[model samples]
Target chain A: MLGRIEQKVLRGGRLTPEEALALFETDDIHLLGRLADTAAERRSRGRAYFVQNRHINHTNLCLNRCRFCAFSRSKGERGAFELSTEEVLERLEGSPEGLSELHMVGGLHPEWPFEHYLELLRAVKERFPRLGIKAFTAVEVDHFSRISGLSLRETLARLKESGLDLMPGGGAEIFSEGVRKRLCPEKITAERWLEVHRTAHELGIRTNATMLYGHIESYADRVDHMIRLRRLQDDTGGFQAFIPLSYHPFNTEIRGGRPSGIDDLRTIAVSRLVLDNFDHIKAYWVMLGEKLTQVALLFGADDIDGTVVEEKITHAAGALTSEGLTREALIGLIRGAGKVPVERDAFYRELNLYGDRYEDRQGDGAEAPDRFRTARARQ
Target chain B: MRKRLHPEGVVTFVVDRNINYTNVCINRCRFCAYYRGPDSPEAFVLGRDELFRKIEETLEEGGTQILLQGGLHPGLDLSFYLEMLRSIKERFDINIHGFSPPEIHYIAGRANLTVGETLQSLRDAGLDSIPGGGAEILSDRVRQVLSPRKIRSAEWLEVMEEAHRLGMRTTATMMFGSVEGPEDIVEHLDALRGLQDRTGGFTAFIPWSFQPKNTELGETVQDRPLGAGGAEYLRIVAVSRLYLDNFPNIQASWVTQGIKMAQVALRFGANDFGSTMIEENVVRAAGVSYRASRRGIVDAIRSAGFKPAQRDTHYNIIRRL
Candidate 1:
């Protein structure tokens, strides 16, 4: 299977997660290189993209006790807290500038009514009619449905009505239950996690997928993770990007988990080579820091995720990729990484392409030409 | 020349935070985009009050160690470090993982004290450990071209040796893919191995790429035949594993390289995935960005076929997540 996949990948074909996993173990680095290059080319066939978004985690107070989580506070912990809908709205109001998207995701709050979340979404959508609402993870969706005593279909319907445009790929922590049990036991089963994202896709909403690495799993487990995500993406076709998250072993329930940095970069490159289906591989600017993310572009990642006006989850987990980054900073990082910077919409749509699209004023006084003049940005 | 990674599997004792004690530094190293000139408004040689506050915050965040890394200021000396270390131990009673090779060498030169005496003084004043900073491509050609005033490779490794002889263990780092070639990388690893072969006081060897952003190095990324790709990243890991044959552990550089490439570096030969940095402004300021938490890194390693264990500055396994 690995050999066949390598051949196909060399011929510019897609490999399944199973194939990717098998290929990961292959000693043929050249063959693997061909497969990765093919996948990258395929992923970039259309216009490359980036997003201008603000990450507003509604609440840090979570009901489910995921052991690997350092961010979540038990309902009664000193720092445990949830934001009111007005507070969430106020955060959104701070982001009405150039941002066209508000990314909201948080722990499964113990007692926020389903309608309360919808109100949060509805308020932001109503307030900024143009800004797309990319809120919640599949875990939150399942939680809201169970709490509201409504099936997921009805829950999603209500959310869609409340102006939920898409979902950010958090809480799909790992796809394997064996690993998930050890890391984050109470969040959701691996299968159920995929189910929530899959169901969201059925409702015509696109979502991202994520993998948390460098903790307690094996290489085979990583392969298993990519395979699971690829299989699900193949079935649902909803996953737009695959974000491979790095683990920091600080201020968490577990005693120790200091992974090597090189291993982190290797996982990302392998993910790109292996996950043949996912379009964008994001070097999320939050966890790995800005410099590493810039270098990540050469390895296999194309998309450097947005300037998160605010981020709580990674911060809660003792990482600094939280808070905001201006578009100029984002473009600067991307340009420094030596790639053409293209501003993207919420759902992976190109908004504006900068650098070289318009010549420097010293060279050409003419106005910049709209490269994709008819490009319709999908929110 | 078999490769090695200094002292392997030593760091895993307690929590550590990268306290860029002061962004203010006097040196203008070409590759360093993170530092601010000493006179700049943004420049800040963290006051005793600010350092104590930062240390208190790190302790509150469950950190046991602080990496107090900055630049080689021209005027600061042995007294400067003695006071900083003394103040920290005086106030917090936490571990002081401060300074690096160049700073030590510079202080030794300024104080007219031997490297051994300087480290001895710092250790006496409660300096616990040293981060391997100013190690941007450990070749003299790269060193002179990058930062002419900064101590050369021999001086940098000499300080580590003197500290090791004086009963202080420190971490070693390699800043590769800047100006030096692969052979230069071998030089850095070899120097580390030679020192570890004798003193055996080096804790771990960390190699990160040069982030060229807002730096004196300017906007010049190499268009080499085989650039800093996954293959090159893996080679560094594998070679570090092989060349530093006596050094048992090679860390995956998630700071210079992203998490995925860091993972692949595991295959080449890396046993550790650095820190779950609470706050890393230096690398981010240079522009490589990706953020991962305790859960994310653990899951990544688990998924990649290893038990994610958090370690201390000495590489002692603290928690097996």
Candidate 2:
């Protein structure tokens, strides 16, 4: 008899909540990987999408210090730092030329007014008008709405006017109430986080979604989280990609080991299967490390996030993957997996298509006698 | 080794049927399971009705050609091949990619004609092109052990070189992972490379693993390997692309590797998806039963991130999708 999940997958039907939970229990990692890979291939057509962008974490000091986060620091604490507008501009000046996006997300600050964020965005945009600024997470947006006493839509619009081109998908630590209450009770509720993104989508602001996994979250909780993201994507069509952030537990209140490589891959594969409406599924190399992210490309991940320079949040949580990767190195990683390395921009617009070096040799029977002799001698 | 050797993003395949006309091969090689002795129950050539039926079905499936290759039947005269080709050409507007180098050599010897004269006669009867059959491993040592009664490596190249001189195009193939080692494989490739250097008449090079199941050779080996997995297949494909510089196209044999690995081959220097074998018997007789329809080939090519196209036997684009 065919298993229910297999039946659903073979029929190309949407995975139900129960079926997804069942699939999450499957130990046949290759099956799940193949299923996810088939789905990803159908969508992306063998081209893994990535971007040349810079990550800017503006501040690490926050009022709501979630247990899962190690970057948020109390006021006056050691290693606590916040970037002023001048400091942000100075950091921007160090970014490599031809960067297409500026990704910014940091802790919720207690004293900085909403205008501080606006001024920082404006200054960066004035410096590089072509750079798409994908700043702030849903939690940051909600915090902005609350502190500024503006509606979610109004706050998003004001930020949009202030040059916030898109929203980052973060702070959606598993959508289950139990997981949220334990890991981050002070943070916004799961419903509120979705509502913030929904409002952003309604305001014509494209956003990405993320789920932090491998920390006190059940298989059911992970499935439910992705299903909810898929539901929102179905309604809004706003989520550009769904990223399953592997939880890092170094120097954090939540004391547990990091997710195993299999766990990380399973989550990524399950995300690709469940988030059917999401076009891109990302393996954030920063969180999952570089090796696992490379493997995740075959496990249904078509995006390796980006060449994020100087990432602090995951690095603070003890991520051992390099703080940054060169664009050439990133292209090599994708090519090593036998995929076309496409350099995409902030909005997933393909900036440059890096054709593999071997693909260009036309072999026009053009023979160089010396080179042929050398090759023959070596063989 | 992801190279775009072709300017067009489209990966081309031929919608053709590999219709074996005769199973009564005189050389009953040890590596083959499809051939039979003339007295065997299955050692019968396809009658005109069966041949026309296969052609009709191929055309119905939107196939533009038929890969008509067969064993060297001892009794069948060269006139038999000519009449079959003429009848197919008169009846249907399908390309007849008939006869391989070995078959051409055998037919010429039996009819007391030169290889050029034989190929010209077949071409006049509307033999559009030739399939690269029976050029398994162009190393005589491998050929002696695998199929001793068959033509030698040089004779195979001689037939192809002569066909090219007669203005006829053909494909080249290698059936490796049998008794051939890396040096022998290189020798095989070197022969094709050398011949192609002089006469660039070869359209593509297809390297497929020797399917061992149900074959006499499969039964003879005590510890038979799993043939060529994707990694080995990919390595050969990559090397073939780098080595066979004179050849324009490399084909991924989905008949033996299945569709997914064949799709992966598009990135591994294979610019063509061989053929959607509407009717295949050789590999099927070897106990690997992978089938590809026209739509399946198109989807496989597209899934591999290339535009899928239909091409003629000569690698000319027939239609692009």
What does candidate 2's lDDT look like per residue over B95-199, in tens digits? 888899889999999999998899889899888788788999998888889999999988899889988888888999999878888999999899999999999
- Per-prediction count of colliding residue pairs? 111, 3
| Candidate 1 lDDT for residue B255 | 62
Candidate 1: docking tier = incorrect
Q: Would you give the TM-score of chain B in model 2?
A: 0.97
TM-score of 2: 0.53
TM per candidate comes to 0.63, 0.53
Cα lDDT tens digits, model 2, A64-170, are 99887888899999988988899888888898887888999888898999988888888989988989899999889998888899988889999999999889998
Ten consecutive residues with minimal summed lDDT in candidate 1 chain A?
A: A357-366
Extract clashing residue pairs from model 2.
Answer: A358-B3, A359-B3, A359-B4
DockQ of 2: 0.01
Q: How does model 2 fare in lDDT?
A: 0.82
